[model samples]
Target chain A: MPEERRLRIPGLKDRIPAACDFVMHAARSAGLDERAVHHCQLAVDEAVTNIIEHGYRGDGLNQSIEIICRAERDRFVIVVVDDGPPFDPLWQSDPDPLASMEDREPGGWGIYFIKKVMDEVVYTDEAGRNSLMMVKHVQDAPRLENLRDHVALKVSVSNPVDDIWLFAPHGRLDARLCPGLDRLMTDKLEAGKCLLVLDLGDVEYVSSMGLKTMVSLWQRARECQGNLVLAAVQTRVHEVLQIIGLDLVFQIFPTPNEAAAALDNPPA
Target chain B: MLDINVSAREQVTLIEVRGRVDSANADQLGEALTREIESGHTQIVLDLAGVEYMSSAGLREIVSALKRAKRGPEAGDVRIAQPSYRVREVLEMAGLDTVLQIFPTQMEAVGSY
Candidate 1:
């Protein structure tokens, strides 16, 4: 059975947070991971902010906006309705993401982000109400197929200790690089070196594919009576782990040395 | 909720922002950046290590600040450091990552200016 939730707020600027929180809570309850929840929250925030600012024309004290979230088996949907004049945010053209600083303009980014993060977006006007619908899958469908075939993940392995090995991977750990990391880690686990530390000091990003790779490595290591730990996680990657609830599942350390020490000590 | 802290260095001014940056308090961020720019502190390094989430409204403020900082004769720049994953994703989606110089560390961002 699909679950549905609804929230209505005055078109005031202060109420945007409430609307966003309601959507986030609903997204989480629908079994969407933290990254998906964040994306939903962003879409809602953008839609509501646009309603209050552009739709209401800065006078939203009396207007009201309605937000509805529906969780299906495979996807989650957010619908926002505003009792304002006819304004379709998607009508605006997308701004160039690669434009130079001098050529950059900020006005069109809100709509651009909405389109980028959400799997689908639709806008409608009926009975004097404007509605914007955004949808995101629970397990986001893969967009880049065979990406690993072209790009290579630069990984360096260091046997810092007799029993522990540290693997440092550079660049983004997305679909293109996760396969390589997975293969490398799998090889190490098969070789009886199960106690592993992933040094993410140079890793700039981690996609859903990367998280899946890490989980797989962790599970494989545990099956062999060994463990995998993360080390030197950058601030952004750390936050991603926390958002996806992996912070609790993974033993994260500040440095490779500390991670090696933990591997030796082992929480008993 | 949002918390912004500003400290002026000899060559660059560092602004540390924490918490959620949304429509409700985006004006505060805009004002802070404006304050620095008005005071002739064009060389700015924004540290987003603590930012939990940021909306398009917050990104707008950043772009506005970047434009204002680079407008006049002094021609200062705004660089970013240590943006959280969510914030970085949004910035990248908005194409601000291409327009602005982003460093991995605060020291690097400040040093770039």
Candidate 2:
């Protein structure tokens, strides 16, 4: 049987998160993987947040939003209803996700995310209510987005020790360069390197997408009983890791040599 | 909406950002910081503990602040402190942690300046 959940909340900003969390958990329990679950959550979040912000304009304290998450054998369906002004996300022009920071402006992304993440999205206004319907299939077709993207990072692979591969990625390691890093790590792991060290001394920045990539790499390494170590993390980068508490997740060293040395001794 | 409260502590302008700093309110936060920089309040300590959710747009705002803070040779920097997990995750994601000063406490961030 298809599992389903429904939630109705004041279309307030604070309530939006709870709605998203509820949907995300429902999606996860419905057998959606992490990536699919996140996509669904983002789609629902963006869609509802729009209604609360632009549609109502009054903080949505008096308005109500309805969210329904239903999971079929091979798909997840999300439906959001609002009593605010008639607004349709499908009509908004697409924003370039890869736009340079100089050209990128804040906002206008709610609809864009809804379009990218959801397999299908339809909007309708009937009888003083706005409805947004979104669908997510289990197996999405392969995306060619990365193929057209231009990565900004310069990755140089070095093997300083046997059985351990060191990846030194330079430049901005944001979402744009994550695919490259993911590909590199996959190749290295598939080649049977048991230990890995990422030297970030030359890296100037690591975006949230970059952090996700690192976490994914660390998780993959652990699955094989191998390890991924972070070395030469600069002050700013180190602080970010500490702030995020990822410093505890991975064995961190002040220098690459130290990381390599620790790998030899092994971590408890 | 992002609620930004600015208070001065010696040489640092302490800006506390509350609420989510996503695409919706990111521009307002960026413009607020730009006003501060234009007013010569370069030394800054940003408290992010109240931020519930943050996205790349928020990171871009910080990057802009960093650039504004480093405009001159004698310019002060924008220090970050007490970031919530969501804020810190995006910070780590952008690798901005390598470029920005992040302290564990607001006092530490201000004291560093």
Candidate 3:
């Protein structure tokens, strides 16, 4: 049997949370990591919100929105259907991100974010019903046991310096494993070991939750007059950070030892 | 779910938002920001540390507040402090980071006023 779930809700802004919860449950059950789950949630949220605010307008109390979620082996697909007018959110011109405050408008971001987060977004109008199909590729987390072994043995056993801590995490840094890493880093911070280096040499992929964990730890480190740096980030993971300009915020080095050394010697 | 807390200090009025900000409650947020602006409290520091999620609706309110705060005789600005990771990403994606100044701590955001 194909893995699928369906929900029908009133085309109202108040029903957005229900729609999001229904999709999220399916996404999580499909083994999508936290980042993909968030993407799914946001995509659905924007879609439903758009339908209520624009498609149904204030008359949504009488209208209904139907949502369908399908979990394929390689991808998760969401389809939103409504009886509203024929309007394609994808057809709207993207708002200029570089526009000055005077020229900027607040209307286009909902659709823009939907496009950016989803791998594919397709809008279709049949008869009088409108349907939007969004797809997100499911990135499987790497073998957790192997990664656990690598992190357990390396971070806990080796210490080139007492003050600067080094953590070499292997495999994908997705939602499944970020909580573990977050706890470990949080413990270090609580113990007053603030200066830290994350060796991303073996990390193959990063999820939104993983990025959040890193940023949270970095901020915490800075709050205590310490810093967190990245080292040997793989090209794929590095590209993710670079896209969002996080590379400028966190000092990245070629190797963990170098990252540790930099942390040891503060620049005036 | 949304919670808005407003506290007035000597330099800036701090609005701390927690929970999700979507179309459902964005108007409430806009109203809260507008209430402060109408009271001539344009020097605002938005503390987003507790915010779990925010969409374009929330961004709209913040941008509107920033625009409103900059106008009039006592022109001031709205600053952000300690945005959650997701909130920060949304701001960057919307290109609001360039227009609205962001600080690492609430103290710094207030001090900038």
Instruction: Give candidate 1 misplaced runs (Cα > 4 Å).
Output: A141-268
- The model with the greater DockQ, 1 or 2, is 1
Best by lDDT: 1
Candidate 2 lDDT over A223-247, as tens digits, reads 8888899998888887888889999
Q: What TM-score does candidate 1 get on C-alpha atoms? A: 0.66
lDDT of 3 by residue, A29-135 (tens): 98888766776888899999988888888789989999999998777889999998887664365677778988887666887777667655656454568878777
B9: Cα error in model 1, Å: 2.0
lDDT (10s digit) by residue, model 2, range B1-113: 78999999987899999986655567888988898888888888889988867655577688778776777456668889999654564455444566778888988888887
Q: Lowest summed-lDDT stretch of 10 residues in model 2 chain B?
A: B86-95
- The residue ranges of model 2 lying beyond 4 angstroms of the native Cα positions read A100-102, A141-268, B1-113
Look at candidate 3 and tell me the lDDT of residue A194.
90
Instruction: Flag the better candidate by DockQ, 1 or 3.
Output: 1
